[model samples]
Target: MVNSVPDCDFTADYLTATEADNLLAHCLTALPWQQEDILLFGRTVAQPRLQVWMGEPDAVYRYSGTDFVPVPWDAQIRALCTRLARDCGTRFNSVLCNLYQHGQHSMGWHADDEPELGPEPVIASLSLGHARRFVLRPRAKGNPDRHEWSLGHGDLLVMRGQTQQHWLHGIPKTRRAVGPRVNLTFRRLLGAEVSAGRAESAEIDVG
Candidate 1:
């Protein structure tokens, strides 16, 4: 469950199936989930899926042309982060929780290269519920190669070092009928103040 690519680590069963199911259920009911809008092509539009941003007080993250001040983490999430950090050997102060309600909901190709993430950020992504295809491709030309992995329930993937500098990763939309999936990407934000400035867009809550 490891990759030859430097700084890329994958664990197929980071959590037991029962543990993953319990955690997913807790997050669905406890976390404050919201469907955000991003400014794309000069017009704001809804994000493809629902998400909940949770972090420490200073770990506000900004991306997709919007600033997100994370809500405080739930106790379960904090404990899970502690365990994940210990296993991954990197501390995490923030997390972005994404819930794809069905096959059509997905995340497009993008890199986690926000300024607040600093250089060479370590991102630990945990997946639960339905399995989905996670893809990565090189940004540079002449390396027409693609890497794909089936991120299954309770799987964990860690990307670090120059992974973000040279690669893009995402979960593409699928037409097959699939159940909901929950993904949590843990991050460590560099020094930055939490700003009240919010992007001019609407937030749709489907709770």
Candidate 2:
């Protein structure tokens, strides 16, 4: 509970900083043949991208109204998920891994609301390596509505409750000084298909 935010049941810990770093080093070295960078707004963005896959055979990840086949998991990743779940005070089934090479590499404005996420899905995020600004803004119109913080190596962020419904979060690209960072967001998609057409839609990797 080192970096616990106010009114946020979530807790961010640096307890396993060293271990996380060690695991990340191994991941960088052995995560199969690298995944191709996906196009984002026609920029063909690179690092800070993703590989949406499921852990179980029946597990399927739905992102941006699309489905995806999860890549196979290794021991290190499985251990990471276990640790993150215990730290976040919730359970997780799938993990979305992100590789951010530099300060310029970042995620944009968006909420994890794929309809498949259900109402108020719980999201546990783990950061390894470089530190960057993590910002959250209220979805509703408001004058003073910007919340930002720096998440360094080993920090864990758990967002729950009405967070997804009321706010949108992102890791904006910055020209500031930084190094490579890898983040894994663990999520649980309770077997519920909100719509029928969604099940047939092509899985689009719009990073």
Candidate 3:
């Protein structure tokens, strides 16, 4: 799928110095140190998030085939999750945070299309610190038109239903002098395989 692109929720919010600092403070204090993998290029990346599970207790995603255990919520984390959900006009009980220390850190192109997320999943994303470009390309089976946006500090990018299924998204590298950056995404998930015993699961194994 790479032909048509959806209407862009590709947006960013410029923050006053204080506002950016405040969010960064919460993320640093509240978020756990994330373990990450090198993307397509084998570069280092960090994603701190709670685990999420769907379907049967051992059920794994068709895409990543991962089973995870959720991280207990920190006070700041809970507050951020709640606020983001309210702002995006959606409800989310979990969040994934990515931390990039310098220009070299980045993520490869991919879609959050796992089955557990249910069809047409909703994502609420918040960015802090250095500004970075987030590129999105149509993956409509045979299309190639691409769209891009710069996610500035304190910016919020909300990806809605159909957004993930139709396209791939990623953070590209930059040569400009940029400080550390953090991103938070909130989403809700449920599936037939998930039961009370196996939730709070998340895994980031890219095939």
Candidate 4:
């Protein structure tokens, strides 16, 4: 099965454990990580985890009132991007990397449906480090169905089609003592003058 959520897929063994370990080490110390404070629930608060945005110079991304400029892609990252692009049959101009230090550092529910991302964007996520619970909830009312996945090291998950519009996904906090985990979400951003192409959507649009 591609995914528990419609229009998505998960590869449990995308990379070898040894390869994952090396990449984890390189990312942990090589990349410049930052924690940004964002407006949440009418109050500004620091994000629980550290993150970095890397991509093409023109690929600017903004979220929660914070505008992010792209950092030049590292050599290792560029290589991975090339491989993923070839494998997925799509180009990704940017990647948002999030480092979860422990179980307490988590991400809240959110979709990747940004204007710059255009409609029906394909997102590729690579997981490295400890295992954690990633949850997806159907946005349609009365369905009340939710799906959860245990994302571990060297795994890859792809979300495509109208999944973003119809589902909300996040990494919730856990009480268990867990090691650090890193997530790289690759996305293709549309230029200001560009228009989105037509594509099919999921059965529901919760928002």
lDDT of 4 by residue, 26-89 (tens): 9999999999776554556788889999999988755665677888998888888998899889
Superior by TM-score: candidate 1 or candidate 3: 1
The residue-by-residue lDDT of candidate 1 on 1-207, one tens digit each, is 223364688998899988999999988788888999886656778998999989898777555467788899899889999999999888999899999999888887777776667679999999999999988877676766788899999999999998877877778888899999999999998776533223321222211
Q: Model 3, range 1-207, lDDT digits (tens) per residue?
A: 333656456555544667778878877666665453322223333442222221123332232222354566666656767776666677675666678777777766677766667778888777887788888776555666777778888887887768777777888767788888888777776653443222212222321
lDDT of 2 by residue, 27-122 (tens): 667765344444344444343554445365545744433446567677788887787677666777777777777766667666776666777788
Task: Give the C-alpha miss distance for residue 172 in model 1, angstroms.
Answer: 0.6
In angstroms, give how far residue 72 of model 3 lies from its true place. 1.5
lDDT of 3 at 75: 63
Which pairs, if any, clash in model 2?
48-99, 53-70, 54-70
TM-score of 1: 0.89
Candidates in order, TM-scores: namely: 0.89, 0.77, 0.73, 0.89
lDDT of 2: 0.65
lDDT of 3: 0.62
lDDT of 4: 0.81
